[model samples]
Target: MSTLAPPRPSPRTTASAGLRGPARLVVRQHRRAFQLLILLTALTAAGLVAVALWAGHDADVFARTGCRVDTVTTDACTRSTRAYDDSQYRLNHSLSVVALLTAVLSAAYGAFMAGPALARELESGTHRLAWTQSVSPARWLTAKLAVPAALTVACTLVLTTVCTWFSTRGTLHPLYWHDTSVYGTTGVYPFAQALCGLALGTLAGLLLRRAFAAMALAAAAQGIAVHVLQNVRGHLWPVVHGPYALARSNPFPRDAWMTEVGYLTGTGERLPMGTCFPIRGKFGDCLDSLGVTRRYADYHPKSHYWPLQLVESGILLAVAALAVYAAHRLLRRLHA
Candidate 1:
């Protein structure tokens, strides 16, 4: 039998060779998108906060002066702490938009950034060249994931922390602001969750070897998982308390979709702005005239918030792990 020769180190064995190019490639491809997204998100959030702070103080002035435009300037010039209700309409609306924007943009960006590194290499046959060289497939994948993942996680955490701080001050009827709509689902926590989705999407891109295709699959996977988990896990394993009811006793104007007034009263009824009127003759006429009559209370279980977040974050991390595993396996199998 012919003697077998010992294996020789591949040309790309040197640390400098395998890493530098891929690192640059990832940054160059994704940098502009990241910058634009961050700029837009921050700017929108800032604008909203500015408007809220201004409006919060102005609201009290308007109330005191019976909304006379002339007194507005005087009131603003001598603004007092009492005038500023931190949990006012502008603040709530701003925070809601910020939350939704952060969630959608983060998810999209994360997937976009991650969708092309290894799969493209595999598609183009360059991965085989690297595999033939001395570069370990696992190491290559690690390098590919580490830099972006770290940067993304750090960035998201920073933004979310700040947003969460502001969010705590918001006082609008939480249910009115947040419902089962898309706007309700996104928030500071959701942004963090989306980062995990991005990591998983990126991992999928590496394994699947196509950007849009992998991204589509990733998005679908995330959407379905989030929906199912939000429903099932929320009902079964709630983090916050449950069966919490909203306290709006009056019907909002037919044209009015949401309200920014009042707190939950005892017995869980929405106490309307107008003084309570007994359901008697003259009182009924007054209710009809001003449209201020009692109705059923609005309610939401507290479990909707924290527990859902915990579950979504866990699922995303799981997806990220699976992506990493698949990337390692596929890259290892590539032969020169």
Candidate 2:
């Protein structure tokens, strides 16, 4: 059990002397998969850049024809915009699909961790080859994690930056910002989510030690975690409460992600606007009749984006750390 815990000097040793063999071993073992990972990253980044440039060119061409994307349709504007509109529609649809794919990337990472990174080695008894060598379990696990973690982090960082830049640059496009897909694809959260998935899946594999079962457990558990996080996301941050002025309220700043809209009482209790249904009187009269002290709009302004992202990333990273610690402890116990 003591040997399961790396020596105090192991960190420096591992960084310099210990890792060279194991890291190369792990990469060689997964050479095809590793190569595929690199190839996909390069292709995806290049393709996204090309698409953005092409879309920008199309938009500029449409603008040259004297049309605006947001304005009411005139005959000439309508005729000219048909091609541009089609292209934009397809692009937005693709964006949504890509976002959905990005959200599930964590699940894929988890599955890979369980199925290949740990379980396959264990099931095939190949891990013993490393453990039987100068490599300790800690170093073996570190080698396994470090390579994939680096690749996953770099992959998400590049994709997120590209997607965010493209999405924000286009004024005619709407912010899908509040959507889980959009949020998943555009920030630090995606990589954090992937890291958490890897850790949790590695832990699961360490526990189960069977390839298929561990893969299923890891994928399902991580997927559910991501879904739950998205569902409870609105509560993660304190929402900005509204101008009691409602319609006349200074109006939410552009791109604010509104979470709730309703009326409030003097006690600050919320009531839906429908609660004041009027048979004949105006909406204002109905509100007055109900003693509605003020209207409420619970929202997250655009400024909250980074704050929310950072907070969520913090949570995911914390969980990842715990999972890795548990994996470390479990591996020690198993090898003891």
Whole-model Cα lDDT per candidate?
0.54, 0.80
Largest lDDT belongs to which candidate? Answer: 2
Tell me the lDDT of model 2 at 13. Answer: 77
Q: Candidate 1 on 20-126: residue-level lDDT in tens?
A: 75566556755776576567656765675576566656665546655442344455533532344443655666666666665565557446644655556656766
Supply candidate 2's per-residue lDDT for 288.
71
Candidate 1 matches the true fold with a TM-score of 0.59
Residue 333, model 1: Cα distance from true site in angstroms: 3.1
- Model 1 is weakest, by summed lDDT over 10 consecutive residues, at 238-247
lDDT for predicted candidate 2 compared with the true structure: 0.80
Q: For candidate 2, lDDT tens digit of each residue in 88-139? A: 6655665676677676777878888898989988989989988887889998
lDDT of 2 at 217: 94
Clashing residue pairs, backbone N/CA/C < 3 A, model 2: none
What are the per-model C-alpha RMSD values against the true structure?
10.2, 6.2
lDDT of 1: 0.54
